[model samples]
Target: MQHPLAYRMRPRNLEEVVGQQHLVGPGKIIKRMVQARLLSSMILYGPPGTGKTSIASAIAGSTKYAFRQLNAATDSKKELQIVAEEAKMSGTVVLLLDEIHRLDKTKQDFLLPLLESGEIILIGATTENPYITINPAIRSRTQIFEVYPLTPHDIQTALLRALKDKERGLGNYQVHLTSEALELFTTATAGDLRSSLNGLELAVKSTPSDENQTINIDLKTAEESIQKKTLSADKNGDGHYDVISAFQKSIRGSDTDAALHYLARLLEAGDLKSIIRRLLVTAYEDIGLANPSVCQRTVAACQVADNVGLPEARIPLADVVIELCLSPKSNSGINAIDAALNDIRSGKSGQIPNSLKDTHYKGAQKLQRGQNYHYPHNYPNDWIAQQYLPNQLQGTQYYQPKTNGKYEQALKKTYDRLYQLQNKERGHHDD
Candidate 1:
């Protein structure tokens, strides 16, 4: 049985590995480790087709060790024990465990002794972050290295190499790929070399050779082989938080276009809860007092979105997103509260003013709690000159409203007037 082109084109050694120059390049960490023949157990992590498995395979080939492959998702404890026994007999076996994050306690426990004894030189591969998914004991035993996505140029180089290599690749077939077809493969896969190679192979094998004995693959064929790349997202994964962060930042930065783009991505991913939550957070955290009405509108929009889920939910979501993107922004409300909380946390919470203390309880008059308190409603403008904060924080201003929007501007005027009246009263009393 013939293996897939992607498998056949796997880099046999470190030298043939196309991407991840940071790790496998000359004098790099992995290369140096390979050259010194002092290989240690390590975790290789990154996006798919970025050569996590290939790097493990290349390292095994370079060191001339007995290489064993196992999938953590399907392989059982018995299989792991078999690998461990082989490692014990071989003195040192390079075990390439794919989806290493999926390895349960049983398999991990079975491999721990072998790993510690230096019999199994484990090279674990994972698409998820090892720190988050793998056992901490296993993580501590290995040096973690992240293999980034292959660059377009790097992927293109791999494709060309596969096309010309006859032993394992499609060199025997005369395949003519137009520039447009090549672009479709390169750009559409988004730096996934495995997808690119498989698409190329499908394009070549499916199309029959003409009378001239040549297979001409066009742009349409390439697209059909590797459909348009779907946006890489996991609603419960890092991509979820990442997109929401981008959406909020775009709105804060006043970039309507970017905000809409991120919103569209989240909506397409069907993460309605995240969209509604982020919109509410962005409204208060970013728009804040600068445009307080935005908070109300955003809340209403969220209600609408919740009532009518996606497809139609996107309408209200777009409304809120656009309004927020164009709205005046302020962080002062949150900043003021955080500053006050910090002060309180630092043990600066002075006693509440005597007059401001609650007087509804029994024996309140005997304690003289409300003795000097003047009702503001009894005075003009329903306001009175009195200390609302403790003595230590009497004159300390927390909410310094900005004049960015009309609402805050009017608020600033009222706030300034109250302070002015209080200062005048204090001056008169001092005289």
Candidate 2:
């Protein structure tokens, strides 16, 4: 029986491997390792179908070392032992352990010594965050490198290679894929070349030949085959957070178009919870104080989006994204809190002043609580120049209010007034 097109199309060497130029490119880390014949156990983490397995195969082929494969979740210990025995016999073996995060204590125990002895070069692949999931024992023994989704151009290059390739690919079939079909085939799979190539194989074999004996595959056929397995956006992968980061940053950068673009991607990924969480955070973290009312509006939009699930949810989300992108941006709110927290964590906080302490109890000035405290309501303008912070952090300033929006401008005026009055009463210069 013939193997799948993806299997047959596995790159035989580094040159054949598509994309991942950061690692496998000229003079890159992986390339350097291959050239020096000094390979180490490594974990490749990224979304599915981004050439994790292909990179392992390419490395083995390039080094002319024996390559083996096993699944950390499915394969038995006996299978691992067999591979270990083969490694002993062959002196060295390149083992691709898929789903390395699922590796149990038992399997890991068996592999650790072998990895130490340099008998097995384990290339563990996973779509999960290895730092969070993998055991420290395994992590300490290996380096972790991240892979990324292939670009549309990279996907197109692989598809064309499959079309012309005869021995491993479907070259014998007289197939004619239109430019539109080719574009859809390369792009719809979301950087998964395996899906596109196999979809091409299916399209070629299933589509009947025309009067000219040429199997014609159009955009419709491409859509059917490729979209059947919509990789369901690996939200747990780094790619998900990357899009969220981009979304928030775009809003922070005031690029409405880029912000909406990333928002569309996140919404399409089907995780309303993550999208909402990111939006709420962006409002306070990035747009803080500058446009205070926008924060409440963001909350309202999020409520609406949460109440009505996706497709329709996109409507409210779009409105919030546009508003946030155009809103005056400030990080003063988050920065002030973070700075105060740092002081608290560093033990700079002193005891609360007795005068400012609680006075609602029945002690009746025995401990002098609230003795000298002046009620702000009794003072003019409902404010008083009193020391609220601890004696140690006397003149510490935390909230550096920004004059980005009208609301914050008004706030800054009041803050400046209070600072001047407080500094004079405390016998300190305005800082």
Candidate 3:
């Protein structure tokens, strides 16, 4: 009996691999490496089901070097030793290690000698970022090539082949997939080829056989087999753009649950960078003044992400999310400053009114720049009244403090004193 559609669909050669034409196409660097027998130790880093393993296999088949396989999560140091000895005797060996990041520091140290000796050309495969996950020493020794998710055209081409090919595919099933079904499969899988094909096969098997045997994979069946059709983040398109907009709005609206749900969708769809960017924006723009610390922490998280990269960086982003959501809400101060800026932009260019201008300049003395400019600290409580803006815009309320937290309380006291001084100054002007 044959295996499942996904299992059966594994590419037999580099040519059979879909969606990575840049790496496998004629004149490509990797193809050149394979052809010239000049392939170096390298890492294939990409998301799941993007053919990291298959790419490794293709390299092995095409190259003249002896190929050895191991899983870092399961293979022991003793097994590594055996492989090391084999490669030492074999002259040139291609060691293809899957989930290479799982190898602890000690285990990775075992391979350094062989790699340095030129006995083993290491090929590491990782879904997580190799730069952060793999030992830096090991990563430094190898060329890193990033593999991206398969495009819809690539998936469509593969699916059509599977439905038509007789030898190693499901041509016998004679499944006629509707356009709607194909769309659901592509969107639901989130660029995971194995997932899309598996869902396709399941949709076909579940449909009752009829004369035409036209398998229509409706949304309901797609959802049932896929367990959950988490909406994809449009990493590029308008739909993805809209969803993210809604997600950010939820956060700004203080709808914590809705924000979290949209966050989950982005995360599930592998929209890590975009999620971090939005969180950073919200930390400052939405939660500012109310909890200034939220912005600081969010920016720090972004830095951590930049320094360390994904999988590990994900934790910091998660921390920022919780802190922003649970932080006491306040937008009065944020709105106030924005309103004030609009006033400055729309109004006629105002002068540096004589009362507020600098007194140090020679001409400024004659212009009466310091005529009424009061040094607030010289007066009682460092609370003397003075106009900071142009005379016409005096007492223009820009930042209205919110009473939600300690910051606002401090602002309220400061504002009251400032207002009193402004009124006193106005009375003097009236006199």
Which candidate has the highest lDDT of all?
A: 2
Order the candidate numbers by lDDT, best to worst.
2, 1, 3
Best of the two (1, 3) by lDDT: 1
Q: Which residue runs does candidate 3 get wrong by more than 4 Å? A: 64-68, 85-91, 205-208, 211-221, 227-431
Quote the positional error of residue 316 for candidate 2 in Å: 2.0
Q: Give per-model CA RMSD.
A: 3.3, 2.6, 13.5
* CA lDDT, candidate 1, residue 379: 85
Return the top candidate by TM-score. 2
1-431 in candidate 3: lDDT tens per residue? 86888778776567888888889889998889888888788998876777777677777777756777899999899988988888777678878898888888878788888888878888898877676777888888899998877877887788788888778777788666667766767666656788888877887788777678665567677767764344553465434665688877887776778877777777766777888788877776677777887778888888897688766776776667777877766777558867977887898347876776677767987776678666778888876655667667766677777776677678789887778778788779769
TM-score of each: 0.85, 0.92, 0.57
Error of 3 at 289 (Å): 7.7
lDDT of 1 by residue, 44-63 (tens): 98777789888988898888
Residue 392, model 2, lDDT: 89
Clash totals for all candidate models: 0, 0, 1
- State model 3's lDDT: 0.76
- Clash pairs, candidate 1, are none
lDDT of candidate 3 at residue 64, scale 0 to 100:
55
